[model samples]
Each structure stands twice: as structure tokens, then as C-alpha cells.
Target: MQNKTRYFIILLILVPVCFSADILLGSTHIPFSIFVDMLRGIEIDETWRIIITELRLPRAIVAVFVGIALPISGLLMQTFFRNPLADPYVLGISTGASLGVALFSLGGGLGMVAIISNFGFASSWGLIIAACLGALMVMLLVVTIAPKVYDTTSLLIIGIMLGSVTSAVVSVLQFFSNPNELHAFLMWTFGSFSGLGWTEIIIMACFIVPLLIISFTMQKPLNALLLGENYAQGLGVRISLLRFQIIIVASLLAGVVTAFTGPIGFIGIAVPHIARMVFKTTNHKTLIAASILIGCNLLLLCDMISQLPGFQSSLPINTVTAMFGAPIVIFVILKGRKSRLHYS
Candidate 1:
């Protein structure tokens, strides 16, 4: 318990430091003193204030939220499926979102850009709505199939199949799309923490914050679920209803973030496992808190690395995350296999 408390305190301190570093590590570095002044609302150089408030601020805020949303959604999916490999990306939720964006941005032709220019509201909301619908469709499909599958392995296969199908469809769309639209879609696929403004941030908060609060209320049931469905039912938990709510919340969290920020990979699959490994507990309560803190810090660190000093152009957010997260995933698979072999 003393060790856990110490780790939590360390993580809490790391969050703000990471956040400030993310904001400060761009092309034009903002001095730490000026950053503090901007926070205090004391007037400084106008250029510095604009950089701090208008540009770096929103990116940092979105990075924090994406960090939080993906890990929690991953945790819920991992628990719900009882599969370490399950995540928004693995389960095809992110691809579903990418499909939505492709259909809206690629299939619709150059006229869609005109729509975005003419109607400022449709610029972001169109993609959000499209992505939500696509994600919901995939979630509904998965839920419909869940009862029929007897094992987690079969379900994981189905998820990979779903992702492949979506990718094929997106490839077709890309082939038919014009250069401008194709370029736009390609860049979005790279993923970004920038481009979202305060309004989009508020929209994301409206969906994510409430759902997260509701997830906390289910920790007791989630803990019971760790024992198995029959055991959870014996403990008076409503299995079907609980399953539905978890699916909806996880789907929406992944969909909304993907809609706004493109489909970020690996963070979802990697972070929850990191939380469990660090705390050495299966308890949802501790895992949830640990995932939030660790998720935020890890993603902020990724964001900073993506925009390293002296680089005029930043690396894609996905590139950096994959570099870190893919190795964690590989280690997990090997460890799981070794454990199974030992038990056998």
C-alpha cells in the first residue's frame, strides 16, 4: 500500500509536467516563465500569448483527453472481452471510424470541401456523426456475434477479419478519390493532436466525461465480472445490461476521439496492460485510476517526441505510438503464451 501510494503520487506529478512539456516542445518554444505568466493571465508578448492560448493550449488539452479516453475504452473492452489483445484498433472500432471518414471525405468528392468551407458547422460535426454511425454499426455487429462465440480466440479472429474488410473498403475509396481528397485522407490517417479547437474539445468533453463518470459506478460489477459471468450473475449483476452499457460507452469513446483526432493506434491496447502490470492488481478501481494517470503521461510523452526540438516537421502521432506500443504488445503475446505453456 505504501508503494502504491508513492507510485500514484509520482504519476500525479508527472501528468502536469508532461502536459507543460507537450505545450512547450513545438517549433517556437515558449519559455517556462512566459508559460506561467500566460496561465496567470498577466499580459506578456502578444505573440507568445497567442501561441500559448490559441495553438499549444488546445493541442495539449486534446492530448490529455485522447490519452484518457483511449486507455479507459481499452480497459473496458479488455475486461468485457476478457482478452488482453482486444482494443478499439484490434476490434475494428477505429477502422470503422476511418471508414466513416473515408466515405464522407473521399466518396463524397471535392464538393464536400466546399460544404466545409461554406458551412463551418459541418466541418467537424459531419465527420463526428459519420464516425459515430460507423462505430455503432461495427459495435452492433460485434454484440450480435458475441453470444455465438464460445471462446475469446474466435472473437479476436472475427475482429481482425472485420478490420481487414474495412481496410479493403477504404483502399477502394482511396483508389477512386481525387488527389486532393486522397491526400487529405492520407494525412488524417497519420493521426494528429493538433487541428482541434476549443469548440471540438467541448464537444468531446460532452460525450466522454459523462460516460467516464458512469464507468466508475460500474467498477464493482466489473470486478465481479473478473471472476466470470456465471459468478457475476450469482452476485446479482445484470450481465446482459452491463454488457450493453459497456459496449456503448467504449464504442462512443473510441468513435468520438477517432472522429476528431483520427484513429490513434496502440495506446488503447498497451496502456491498460501497463496499468495492470504496474499495480499488480486485477481490481478495476485501482486499474482505472492507474490507467488514467499512466495513459495521460505516456501520450503526452509521445506527443513531445513527435514534435522534437529543431525539427521543422513533426512525425505522425501514430508513428511514435506504434514505436513504443507495438513492442509492449509483442511482449504481452509472448508472455501469455509462456504462461499457458507453463500451466499446461
Candidate 2:
């Protein structure tokens, strides 16, 4: 308890530090004095304000929330399934997000205007709704049939097959899209933090804060389940009910992140493993905090790298995440390591 509490405090401090570094240390090299002045109500040139607020601020804010959402969702899924490889998006969440964007690119522009005007922010919720619904449909199908299958590996393979099918469909959409639309769509898929603004950032925050709170609330049940599903039920966990909560929370986390950031591939898988290595515990309480800290810091590192001039043009943000995320995932698999109880 003492160690978990100490680590949580450390993590809370780390988020602000990572965020400050991201805002202050960009390519233009605005010194700390000017950066402080700019943020502290001193008026600079319109260019600086515009650059800071319009471009960099949105990217930084979105980076933080997207950073929080994915890994936490991945953490929930991994715990629920007792399989380190299970990510919220592993069940076609990313594919559903891709197909939503693809369909919107073809028929309407982002579809934000259509969904809104009537629904307000609730309508503004469509991207996540599309993603959640798609993920839910897949989940429903899996649960319905998983009873007969008896083997968990088969369920996992079925999910992979579903993902492959969605990928193929997305490819077909890409094949027919015109050059400009194709370029736009391709850029979205590559995933840059450049385009989102304050409104989107606010919405991402609205969902993420609540979702994190819910995940914390479920920590006890999650810890019990870490002992395996049978043992969790012996401890009075209502298995079906808990599974539903985990799935919903995990899907919401993945859907919101995917909607705004495009399919960021590796954070969901890599950050949980990193957290496990850091905290050396299975308690979702501490693991959650560590995962959020590491996820935000790691993304900040990736974001800084994205702005580098080493490349003629910047590499996409998703590309950078995968470059780091993939190797860590492979290492975790090869090591075949697992979790440990945070408390007796």
C-alpha cells in the first residue's frame, strides 16, 4: 500500500513534467522565458500565439488523452482475458474506426456536422459511437459462440480473422478513393497529432476522465480476476457482470482514442508491459497509474521525435509509436513473463 501510494504520487507529478517538456521544447526553440511569458498572459506576436495555441497546444492536449485512453483499455483487456496480447482494438476496434472514416471520406466530410446540430456533443460522439458499436458487434458475436468453443485460443484466433476481414474491406475502400481523398485518408491512417483542435481535445478529456475513474473503481474485481476467472467467482465476483463492465470500459477507451488519433498501433500493447516491468505488480491500482505515466511520457518522446529535421518530412506519429511499440511487444512475448500480486 505504501509503495503503490508513493508511486501514484510520483506518476501524478510526471504527467505535468512530460506535458511541460512537450509544450516548451518544439522545433522553433522558444526559450523558457519567452514560453513562460507567452503562457503567463504576456502578449507576443500573433504568429507565436497562433503557433502555440492552434498547432502545438491541440497536439499536446490530444497526445495526453489519447495517451491515457489506449493503454488503460489495453490493461483492462489483458487482465480480463489473462492474455497479455489482448488489446481492445484486437477485436476489430481499429478496423471499425478505419471503416467509419473511410465511409465518411467517401459520402460526407468527417460527418461531424451531420451528427451534430441535432445531437450536440452527444452527436459529436459519433466517431466513438461508430467505433464502440463496431467493437460491440464483434464482442457480442464472440461471447455468443465462445461458450461452445471451450478453448480461449480459438476465440483469439476468431478475433484475428475478424480483424483481417476488416482490413481487407478498408483496403478495398482505399483502392477506389481518388488521389486527393486517398492522400488525406492515408495521412489519417498514418496518424499525426497535427489536426485536432481544442474542442476535440475537450471531448477527449470528457470521456477519458470518467473512464479512468471507472477503471479505478473496478480495481478490486480486476485484482481478484487476476487469480483466474474461477477463483474470482469464488471471491463473490459476479463473473458475467464484471466482464461486461470491463469490455464496455475497454471499448470506450479504444474507440475514443482511435476516433481522434487514427489507429495508433502499439501504445495499447507496449505500455502495459512497460508498466508491469516498472511496478512489478498485478494490482490494477498501481499498474493503472504507472501505465498512464509511462504512456504519456513515451508518447511525448515519440512526439518530440516526430518533429525532428533528420527526415526530409516528419514521420507519422503512429509510425513512430509502432517503431517503439513493436519491439517491446516482441520482447514481452519472448520472455513469457506474467504479473504478480501487488498485495497479499
How many times do residue backbones clash in model 2? Answer: 0
Cα lDDT tens digits, model 1, 1-344, are 58889899999999999999999889888899988887887889999877877878898888889988999999988887788888877678889988888888787663443333234322467766777777777877877876688665677788789988988988988887888777877878898988777898899899889988988998999999887778999999998888877877888888889888888999998999899888888899998889989999998999999889888888999999999899998988898897842111
Global fold similarity of model 2 (TM-score): 0.85
| Model 1 / residue 289 / CA error / Å | 0.6
**Predictions: Cα RMSD each:** 2.7, 4.8
Of the candidates shown, which would achieve the greatest TM-score relative to the real structure?
Answer: 1
Query: For model 1, which pairs clash?
Result: none
Clashing pairs in 2: none
Q: Rate the local accuracy (lDDT) of all candidates.
A: 0.84, 0.75
Top candidate when judged by lDDT against the true structure: 1
Residue 219, model 1: Cα distance from true site in angstroms: 1.0
